[model samples]
Target: MSKLDEKVGKYIDAVKDTCGLEPDVDLLRKVTAACGPVIYQRDAETVASSDPDEMDRVKKNFLMKKLGLSESDKLDEGIEAAIETYGRSERTKYRAVFYYLLTKHFGKDAVYGS
Candidate 1:
């Protein structure tokens, strides 16, 4: 399996364990689609960047610090905290929303990768 697949699989497992629900990639994709642009625009504005690569780097740093994710951090806690802080409790699940911001932070190819 590709590294992206591995990461997704690990996160799927983490979500199942933490949230007691299965993660649907399709649903997650929809969530990403709905949220990605706005999140990127805002984050980019925060760092005053228009370049994708620069935005990605800055957003990555911001997310890690904001979400309290260290180098060894797993998806579960970070995602949960994000939902608590930034999500709509009625419609949000950490697993479904995180990939969008992550994609913005790593570039458009982040999900499937280059």
Candidate 2:
């Protein structure tokens, strides 16, 4: 597999193992593609849930802009729900998997053409 495809596979495994959910493989791959090259970088590959700036970026960039969601408390709640589902104790919360959870959580699978 290509590197991106390899990463997507890993993210898929993470969702199944860490989040206890059977992810839509095609949707996860598309979400991971949407994430771009950040997935290739070690530090940027994972999300720091404790960082406010990162959380804001996720809300603004991923949730609102990419997913075409409006600003609301539900957005924040969705982030929290993804974080909670990913396990707060888990340090390496892969961006693809996290975004996949958020997409699934908000019923935005249509955004990824799921």
Candidate 3:
């Protein structure tokens, strides 16, 4: 498997185990497509920001805008909420897990404290 596919595959399994999420291939494709633009902005912010703190705003804006969520203090909350919309979940705030998947897909330099 390609690196991205391998990572997302693990995420699919993780979500299923964590919260009974069962995403189909079509939805996964759409999400992977959306990740392109979001990751681009993330990389840009990483490169542009002298202050590591400022990049959080860029990350939040890209993630929320791509996922069609309202602005929030927490991008991960927005992402988790968006995920819940796709499938109901009893558990909340799986952001850490989600970020782990993203980091695996995109690599540590891009998604994890870049």
Candidate 4:
């Protein structure tokens, strides 16, 4: 299998063991691939920003705009809340939410290694 497939397979297996449900692998791959550009853009923005708050804002804007959730008041507000709660040292909550959204749309087997 390709590297993307291998990573997706591992994710699928983990999801299966945790959720006890099979998910669509093809959809997962598509969503994962779609997320790549967003991740890259976020990384670039983070590198460009010297201030942590500025970096967080850039990341939030990217997430809101790219995810087509710009109008989501709850998500927008929640992101800020999460950032405050988690502080600048880590972003586990945000990452978890991002992965959750990806898996929700693409299934557990979405290929992301490529």
Whole-model Cα lDDT of every candidate shown, in order: 0.42, 0.93, 0.43, 0.44
Higher-scoring candidate on lDDT, 3 or 4: 4
Residue 52 miss distance in model 2 (angstroms): 1.0
Q: Pick the candidate with the highest TM-score.
A: 2
lDDT of 2 by residue, 5-73 (tens): 899889888988999999899999999999999999999999999999999999999998999999999
Instruction: Please identify model 2 stretches exceeding 4 Å from their true place.
Output: none
Candidate 1, poorest ten consecutive residues by summed lDDT = 42-51
TM-score of 2: 0.97
Between which residue pairs do clashes occur in model 2? none
Query: For model 3, how does the per-residue alpha-carbon lDDT over 34-81 read when each residue is reduced to its tens digit?
Result: 455443343431222233453355355544443343455555444344
Q: Give the TM-score of candidate 4.
A: 0.43
TM-score of each: 0.30, 0.97, 0.39, 0.43
| CA lDDT, candidate 2, residue 93 | 97
- Consecutive 10-residue window with the lowest summed lDDT within model 4: 41-50
Model 1 residue 85 CA deviation (Å) reads 10
Q: Would you list the clashing residue pairs of candidate 1?
A: none
**Per-residue lDDT value at 106 in model 1:** 33
